[model samples]
Structure formats: structure tokens, C-alpha cells
Target: MKKVLFSAALFFTACAVSAQESVVKEAKSAKSDPVKAAQIIEPALTDPSTANDPETWKLAGDFQKSIYDDENMKLYLPGGQADTAKLYNSLAKMFEYYTKCDEVEQAKVQSGELKKPKLRKKLAKTLATVRPQLTNAGSDAYNAGNYANALKFFGLYVDAPQNPLFADEDAVKNDTLTPLIANYAALAANSLKDNAAVIKYATIGKEHKEEGYRSLMCLAEAYGKGETPDSAKWLTTIQEGVEKFPSQEYFIGNLMDYYIQKGKIDEGLAQMDAVLAKNSTPYFMYVKGVLQYEKKDYEGAIATFNQIIAEGKDFVAEAYSKIGDCSFFPAQEIVEENSKLSMDDPKYATNEAKIKELYEKALPFYEKAKEAKPDNRQLWGQYLLNIYWKLDKEKYNALEKELGY
Candidate 1:
């Protein structure tokens, strides 16, 4: 018992320390020893096995963060390390790369190497210049509080590095601007999940998920932002963005989630109709299940999510986790709100009975999620803890002992 208590205490202490230490790690790495920095970076850049190690990734992240934060280091990748013409000229080359990919993809379709998607050759060609166009347009939208427009424009800026879209215009006024602009755009977009601007940027990132790690941040933000938007415009904007950027799973998931949160079942279902037009992805299906869950169509949601868990073998764990999360709170909330009366009082019993039904329905989903994500012990433990919360201490103690929590 003492050992277990000590272990739990130590774990909590470690988590707290990690959180506080993260901020300082960035500051310290700025002036790290050259040999040690190089040693860390070598493994990070080349060793796949060591790729996810925090120490290595953080060292590189800190180095880049410091350079970006440094006013002097905010210069060029396209051309000008310092000069104006060189900087924008380098931007032109990035546009040239966008043009290259666009041309290659378009030509592949025309030459029979790829299927002609709905937004094919013409769309691809237009996107070639999209990056450069957004560089100027997104800043305009951002300053005006039209994050929707800014997000859209920023999406264009992703393919071509020279055209940084998400930063303050003043930042772009310098010769060394791309990294600063890129980082800032990423930051700004991340800060506004429901802002249409975030949806737009994430959509672009979704397509180029392979090359742009920056997109991943925007994708997560877009999903988070759209969950409870302030306006209907945000909903429509995100919906449209998802339709347009099917490959951008981040935006699509966020938009669909918004549909669920707003209690717009029909609208969410309609959006799924849109999702079906393109190659269907987990992001799309996940939204559909969540929408049903929000509507209290538990069976429908569970069945749909079950199909996803089965079909998406690689994503089954995440799929179950989502189902668990989607059902847990909603059922709990309903049960809690209804648990006001005694079981014998007809009025009180009505709500209490409903509460039991909700919990009964919800438990299996959470348990299934736990089973699917066995490695995610913390999440599984939390689910068990919650279940125990609804039960007697004797039962809770028994389960806790069984799980060693």
C-alpha cells in the first residue's frame, strides 16, 4: 500500500514537473553547446526509431522557435537571407514548386496516370498561384476580423513557402519573412479553431499532410474551434471548407463536430452526404456517428461507429475512443440532470429510470473503447473511474483493486 501510494505520488509529481519544464526547455536550447546540439539533431533527423523522442524533437523545435522569435533570423528561404528582392524571389520559387506539383498531378490525369477528380486539372492549375495570392489576401482578412477569409487565404499559402499568409503584414514587410510568416500563420490559425480562416488553412494542409507538418497544427485547431462556433456563418463556412478540402481530414472532422454540438442533426447528416461525394474518410464517418449520438439516436450512432471500428482496422482504437467520449458525457449529463427524485416517487422515478437507461447504454461504449485502446491506460482508467463514480464504494473499491488503479 505504501509503495502504491508512493508510486502514484511520484507519477503526479513527474507530470507536474514536465508541464512546467516544457516552457524553459525552449529557452535553454537557444544557446545549447554546438556539439551536443548536433549530436541530438543527428538522431532526430535520421533515426526513425528515435524520431518521436521528446528530447530530440524538442531540441530541434526549440532551435527553430528561437530563430523564429529572433527578429534578426526572420528572413528568407526563397532567396534573400536579408535583401528584399531575394526574399520575395525565393517566394517565387516556392510558387514555382506549387506550380510543379499542380502540373504534375494535372498532367497525370490528362496522361492517364490518375483518375479525374471533380476539381481536377483546372482546379489544380488555379491552385498553382493560390499560395502567392493568399500571401497578401489573408493578412487583409485577418486585420479586419474576417478570420473566415483569412483562413481561406492562408490555405492557399501552404503549398508555396515564400508566400507566408498567416502573419501580421508588418512581419512580411521584411526581406527575411517566410519562416516568420509561416510560423505566425500556423500560430494564428491554431488560435482560431472555429474561425473560418482556420478551416481554410487546415483544408490545404489536409491535402499536403505528407509534407507540411504545419498543417497538422492547423487541422487540430480547426477541429477544436468549430466544435461550438459563435455564429451560423462559422458553421456554413466550415461545412463548405470540408466539402472542398476532403483530403484535409482536420477541417472536415471539426466541421462535422460543430454540427453535433449545435444539435443540428439534419445539417450534420447533410454534411455527411457531402462527405460521401469524395473519398470517404474516418473524419467524415466519425462526424456522422457523433451527429447521431447528439440526437440521442444511440443505436444508430453505435451501429455506425461499429462499422467504422471494424472497417478502419488501423483506426479502431481511435474510433472506439471517440465513441466512448461521445457517449460518456452526454449520457452522464442526462442521467445527472434526471437523478433528482427517489425511485418510488413516480415523477422522481421517471427521471431516475431514465438515468439508469442512459448509463446502461453508455457503459458498453466506454468499456469497448477501453478494450480497443489498452495501451492508453490513463484514458481507460478514467473511464473506469467514472463508471465507479456512478456506483457504490464497495463496487468501486473492488474494480479499482482489480485494475490496480
Candidate 2:
């Protein structure tokens, strides 16, 4: 019985070695026949006899890398259309196999089962050459609306710099594409509604030059809507965005909307006041005025708009329109209220005169706004129409005709 068992053990050992050698031979054919090579090497990865062997994993990695190279080469051929799914999949598999190989090899080195590192330098060099392709894969996936795959590829690219295989590579450290790719990753995460992922990538991306503003916006949205929302972080991020990207309205609009929704318009005004005190831009002052208007502080809004007008900046026309709005909206409220009152009410005539007086007060400001920016119908057109209809029918008819109304 003991002799029979020994013979059986020897036979299995021979079979294992033969299988390992066969897989390696198949891997060599990967350059010309990668699909068949994959069929053989893929199963060898999990087979009990070859699973722990670093050589098997290395062959697998090399096979996938060869497949990627061949597929990428086809892109330069005449009328060659890339199979993006195949290309991305092969790249991802190459990374995975190489990572597994490295892990196994390192373990063997530590265990003294291997005399020295065999594939580490070759793996590092190959990965350094292949790392940048991750960005292209991510972009293709993103444009194709494959958010999950896009995030995967982008995340791998972002992580490649710190990966052990690229430890000696300066190219990863100096790559200018990192920040842009980070922003794209955040955008992909946002499309997937993966708030945590958005925050993760956007935090890194917010320093990019061209896409930083967009990343900052993504960061704020993630903070506001994450599983356990952090309102303070959301507010701070939006404030930072407003300061960094003053020309973009997204941050400021969302900030104001948050305050309005929370019924904290006064708080919003206070914050804008603090910003204005520090940097006193016409844009921030306009935001403050709008917040004051939302709070129904008409007098405060008019004063803020007047200050913006005094500054004589690009906001002058908007300031004039806002000043007109303050009076015009109040007059509209009076009209609504007067309609509810009985015609015989003694206050009815007084309310009608007050409405007309407010309209008269608004007319000059709207006219000034129109004069300042004749092409900006949004600033003054409807307001002027309302004022003329109430205070002067002849001008109202003429203006209506000119407007094609």
C-alpha cells in the first residue's frame, strides 16, 4: 500500500508540472493567438495545482498584455474601428493578473521559496508604459454612458501612481493628466449617483485648472446628498466654489437656494455681506441684494442694489432692474390685496393710488436699465411693459407693437 501511494504521488506531481509547462507554452502563442491562449491560461489561474504558482500568474498577465497590444494596433489600420469593450477588458485583465502575480511573487520571496525577484522589474516597466491608456479607456466608457466601467478605469489610473509596480516611475508622478482624469472620475461617479465616490475623486480633482470648478460643484453636491448629509461641509464647499469660480453661477445659485429652502435668507445675506466685506465685488453684492429681496427686505435690497450701481461695474443694469423689481413686486402685492377688498371699502382708493405711485417710482429705474442694456430683454422688458400699461397707455401700445406682442 505504501509503495502504491508513493507512485500515485509521483504521477500527480508529474501531471502538475506538465500542465504548468503547457500553460507557459500557450502563453508564448498569445502574441498571435491570444484568444486561444486566454482559454487555456484563464482556467489555469484557479486550478488547484497551478493556483499558488507565481509563474502561472505571470504568464496570464503577459498573455492579456499581448492581447491588449494586438487589439490596440488594429486602431491604426485603415477603417479600423476599435472594439472598446474588448480593449478595456483586456487592459483591466492585464492589470489584475500582474497584480496577482506580484502578490504571489512577493509572498514567495518573503517565504524564501524563491531565490530572488524574477518578474518585478519587467512588470513595472510594462505597467508604466500601459498606465496612461487607462485614461483613454475611462473616457471612452464615460462617453458611452458606462459610468461603472468609466469609474473603474479612472480609479485605476488615479491609483497607478501610488501602485507598487510604478514605485520607481517618475512619469506617473509628473503626469499632467492626473487631475483631469480625477475630475472625469468624479463626473462618472456623480452620474452613477455614487456620492462617496464623487467626493473621493472631486477632492483630488478640485485643484485642476480647467475642470476644477466643475469638480468643486460635484464635491458640494456629494456633500449635500451623501448617505449621512453634512450640511456644514456642503455650505463650506459651495462657499469655496463661489470664491474660486465667481463667474460660474452654479455655486452661488445653489447656495441661495439652500438658504431659501431652509428659510434662512437672513443667514445667506449675512454670509454674502461677510464675503463682500472682504472682497467687495459687484457680483457678490448682487447676490446679497437678491437674498434680501427673497427675505422681503425691500428697503435693504434697494440699498444694496444702489451700492452696486454706485460702483459702476458690469452689474449696473442688473442693479437698476433689481431696484425696479423692489417697487414693482410690492405694487403687485397691493393690487392682489386691493382686489380682495370690497369696492366700497374706504381704503380701496388709497390702495389704488399707492399702486400707481409705486409703479411711477419703478418706471424710471426700469427705463434706466433698458437704456444701459438695450439687448437684455430679461432685465427690463416685462417690467417696462407693466409700468407703461399702468401709467401711460399710449407708450404701452407703442412698446407692445415694437416687441411684436
Task: Give the top-scoring candidate (TM-score).
Answer: 2
- Candidate 1, residues 77-115, lDDT tens digits: the string is 354254423333333333333344344445556677678
The most accurate candidate by lDDT is 2
TM-score of 2: 0.75
In order of appearance, the predictions have TM-scores of 0.42, 0.75
Model 1: ten consecutive residues of lowest lDDT: 164-173
Error of 2 at 199 (Å): 2.2
- Can you tell me which runs of candidate 1 are displaced by over 4 Å? 1-240, 312-315, 318-338, 343-362, 375-383, 386-395, 398-405
Clashing residue pairs, backbone N/CA/C < 3 A, model 2: none
Q: How many backbone clashes does candidate 2 have?
A: 0
Model 2, span 46-147: residue lDDT tens: 776676888888878877887788888889999887776788898998888887888888888899999887888788788878888898899888889999
Model 2: CA > 4 A from native: 1-31, 71-88, 107-117, 144-146, 173-177, 226-228, 243-247, 260-282, 295-300, 303-321, 332-342, 363-405
